[model samples]
Target: MERPTRIGVQLAPQHAPMQATIDAARRLEDMGVDAVFGWDHFFPLSGDPEGVHFESTTQLAAWAVATERVQIGPLVFCNSYRNPDLLADVARTIDHISGGRFVFGIGSGWFERDYIDYGYDFGTVGTRLDALAEALPRIRARWDQLNPPPLGRMPILIGGKGERKTLPLVARHGDIWHSFVGPDELSQKLDVLRGHCEAIGRDVAEIEISNGASVRDGIGGVGFERLDALHAAGTRLLTIPLSGDDGPDGYALDRVPAFLEWRDRKNG
Candidate 1:
């Protein structure tokens, strides 16, 4: 059966005070978005790479209590930032607080500054993927080893677009595969994912396909026709990342209206 479309918003944890960030999350929830996410990093990705930013897990733990209805998580937690077993426990605790509304989004580490400044080993891409590959099973095992386990199974969302390592990991382990790609590119990668799934004897449909939408003119640029194509092609969860700076007038929150409208129509 086809799943209903869902919209998620990443509040972009950059250049904002904690209170403002919390308020933004609450507002996004009240506006009827399905999930709220923030990226996992010690520094801002844009503006200044060394600029002030909030860490994903800490921010998410606060967000768990700040909003009751919104499902919250990191867009993708860097696996190198914390030990796998410890990360699983942290996610479990947050899941309990959120009443099982936490999606454990995780990925192999990127960003050399985050690693070097934080005193983590800055390894090669192959080595990092290798680490992630080793860590996944251990994280799952540790979850089971915990006294109560997770609030639920704690759906795993794996983010990345690497065909060689990341997509295979998604095929084998992820409940949702989140990535950003243009429509044609996404279509092509879906084919790659299918090949990965087939090699592993796993059904590709078992994993929810998620894509990022670029919001413009208070609406997503791809429009309803493109959205339909995505849905028909197995993209179940679509998210738009709204930065405070993405607007013409600065700090515009109007994107949510068009996003919600599209989500409603697609789900209907």
Candidate 2:
């Protein structure tokens, strides 16, 4: 059966107070978004480099308690930030906290400033991907051994577009594969991912395809036309980012109702 289309809003944690970020998550949930996300980074990814930011997992835990229906997670947790075993335990705890509403979205670390500021090794891209590859299995193993297992089978969402190493890792482990590419690039990448899945004897369709939509350029900013194109290209999950800097009332959700309407129309 074809999966229903889903919409998510990423409440970017940069330049916002913790309360504002929490409020944004709650509001997104109220707006009928399928999931709410924050990014794992110590500093801002845009605008002022020295903007206010909160820790990702900690904020996610807060959101887990603040909202009842929405799935919560970091858009992609930096694998290099915490020990893999510890990370699994953290995810498990949050899973229980949210009553099985946590999605474990992770990726190989990027952003040199985060590593240097936090004292983690800012190694080469190859090294980071290797570390992520090694860490994923250990995380799963630790989850298996934890005294109280996760409240449910936690879905693992891997974000990246590297065909050689990343796609293979996704084929082996990911429940969802996320990327920030347009339709043409997404089509090519999906083909590559399918090859990896075939090589591993896994069904490519088992992994949900997720893509990031720019609020300033895609569906939210442009119209439903871009969304229709993405839907036809096999994307099941579409995520739009909301920055904290947008307003004092929290992230601007003016575009969400329309997006939700579009989602319902598409799914129906």
Candidate 3:
């Protein structure tokens, strides 16, 4: 039998007070969403470039205590931000904090401002992906050596749609593959991922597929509907990102009901 489809939400880091962000996550968990995600980036991705934004891992630690039940993770952590070993250690710590309810979502670094301001080398895309490729095994190795092992083997989530480098890396290391493109694009990518899995001798079904939901008018769009299409296409995990710092006017909370309604229907 097919697993019931799952719904995940990316609570965007920009524009909200920290406590409000925590509150929102709790509310989502209360409403029975499958997972709650936050992205890893030092700077804002949209809205005012200089707007207030929360950092990923710190907020993840907060989420560990703030909510129970929902799996929590960075939608994709920038592998360039921390050394691979350190990233693994941090993930392990959060795993313990959440009593193993953690997914280590990661990807090659992007966002030039994060690099330049933080004094990390901002290399070309090829170089960054090369770094990530090197880091994956090292991170896994270090996780094994930690004095106290993680509660369960924490799942690794690899985000991105890069065919040659990213998908192959996903094939080798990921438990979940996250991408933002639509169904048709997702179908093609999955084919590529499957081929990579075959090359590596890994069963394609071992990896979960997830995508970002597109929102419009605070009511709907491809966000939830894509779950059905993605499910039909063998992509069961779905994520919708809410720009958390949308101000006291509570624009971000407006979408919660739609998410809840969709989830309730799925559960029903």
Candidate 4:
């Protein structure tokens, strides 16, 4: 089935206190976002080098309980930090807590600081992708073996733009593929994803397309032209980044409603 257009807010879990993120998640849901995502990282991706930051899994559990309607998960949890089976169980627990509103968004690890500081081996990009390749099946197998499986479908959202390893992985495993590219390049990327799906005998339609958009791009910064084009190209989900330092609250979600309104119109 074709997925409806969705507006997702990626609440950056950095610089602000934990409560700010929690509060933002709650309010973002109230604001009518379809999903709320947090990033998996040990330190701030931007801003202060040693600023306040929270862990993704813990925050996701709290978000699962704090909201009633929206889906929750990391933008892309790094596959390096946790064991595959253990990660499966943790995600299943959160899925139950969310009443089955969780989306498992994952990616091969990339942040060097997160690895170096945490004592994880900072391997080459190729090695990390190989590890992720090895982990996906193990994670799925463990999910099947769990005493209580994930609450619902627990759709897996794989995030990346690399045409080689990443796109192939998405074609084989993702229910939703989150791409970092914008409208101008989306068509070309989708072509690559489709080719991979064809090679694997997977129906390209089964994997929902998700792309990152500047709030302005969707809400009025440039205009909805780009968003319109993306929708035409088959992207059903759009995630806009929220800065912790944008305002008093880490969310900076003022523009969310407008984008959501756009989504409603598109879906309607």
lDDT of each: 0.84, 0.90, 0.84, 0.89
Scored by TM-score, the top model is 2
**What's each prediction's clash count?**
0, 0, 2, 1
Model 2 agreement with the true structure over 28-93: per-residue lDDT tens digits: 898899999889999999878998988988999999999999999989999999999999999999
Candidate 2 has what TM-score? 0.97
lDDT, candidate 1, 1-268, per-residue tens: 8777898888788776687778888888889989998898888787766555787888898899999998899888999889999999999999988999999999997889889888999889999999999999999999999988888779899999999999999999999999876667888899999999999899998898998766652354545666666677778788877665555543356767786887787777
- With a 3 Å backbone cut-off (N, CA, C), the pairs that clash in candidate 1 are none
Q: In candidate 4, where is summed lDDT lowest over 10 consecutive residues?
A: 213-222
Q: Write the per-residue lDDT of candidate 3 for residues 120-157, one digit (tens) a residue.
A: 99999999999999999999999999989788889999
Model 3 spans > 4 angstroms off: 217-227, 263-268
User: Tell me, what's the RMSD of every candidate?
Assistant: 2.2, 1.4, 2.1, 1.5
Query: Which segments of model 1 are wrong by more than 4 Å?
Result: 217-229, 244-251
- Which is the better candidate, 2 or 3, if ranked by TM-score? 2
For model 1 the local lDDT of residue 111 reads 88
Predicted structure with the largest lDDT when compared to the true one: 2
For candidate 3, the C-alpha RMSD (Å) to the true structure equals: 2.1
